[model samples]
Target: MSDLKTEADSLNRAGIKLSYAADPLNHPLADFKSASHDLSAFGVLGSLLKATGEVREGMTELADVVTALHDEWQAEGKAMLDVGKVLDQVDRLLQESLARKHG
Candidate 1:
């Protein structure tokens, strides 16, 4: 149980760190999208611009996936903690019942 709680705490901490790391990626992705649009105004760089757009789209998808994963980790960590609490409560109740019966 303690180990479960410890792992949950670690997972929550990791999720928080992932949130922080993923947030910075949004700014750069947005910047790249904006830059891609700006480059679209030139006809000579059309092919290059298309490639850049594709790369930006992939990056955006990657960021979305990372964000979703972080959310899942946070939720799972909380769920684990809740389960641990429930298990601890049941354990205490059993101990008390046994003590009362044997007293």
Candidate 2:
């Protein structure tokens, strides 16, 4: 259905935005390395080491959210397929019933 397609497209765009937000968290180790470099150069890591554990936990939580969203999207697609199959079967059955009555 066009409405479903539209909603799917909107959800896809939202997912993309969420993905971008999560990308920075994906490379925390690399960022930590950079912060270490900064600390050596400027004697300040900007609370980087102090927040490492919290940052890791937050990243994990965000990743879990994204995974959950993906799983829901997959289930929705399957549901749509099932609906279409049911509709097709109903159409076929209706046609058969009509023919039997007329004959």
Number of the top candidate by TM-score? Answer: 1
Alpha-carbon lDDT, every model: 0.62, 0.56
Candidate 1 to native Cα RMSD, angstroms = 4.9
How many pairs in model 1 have backbone atoms within 3 A of each other, for residues 3 or more apart or on separate chains, i.e. clashes?
0
| Model 1 TM-score (2 dp) | 0.60
For model 1, residues 1-103, the per-residue Cα lDDT tens digits are 4554465556556545544554556677667646644544444775676676676677667756766765775566566556656665666676788889999
Top candidate when judged by lDDT against the true structure: 1
C-alpha lDDT (0 to 100) for residue 26 of candidate 2: 44
TM-score of each: 0.60, 0.53
What's model 2's lDDT at 42?
28
Candidate 2 residue-wise lDDT at 89: 60
Q: Per-residue lDDT of 1-103 in model 2, one digit per residue for the tens?
A: 4454455555555555544554455476445544543434322576665565565566566656765765665566555555555555666676778889998
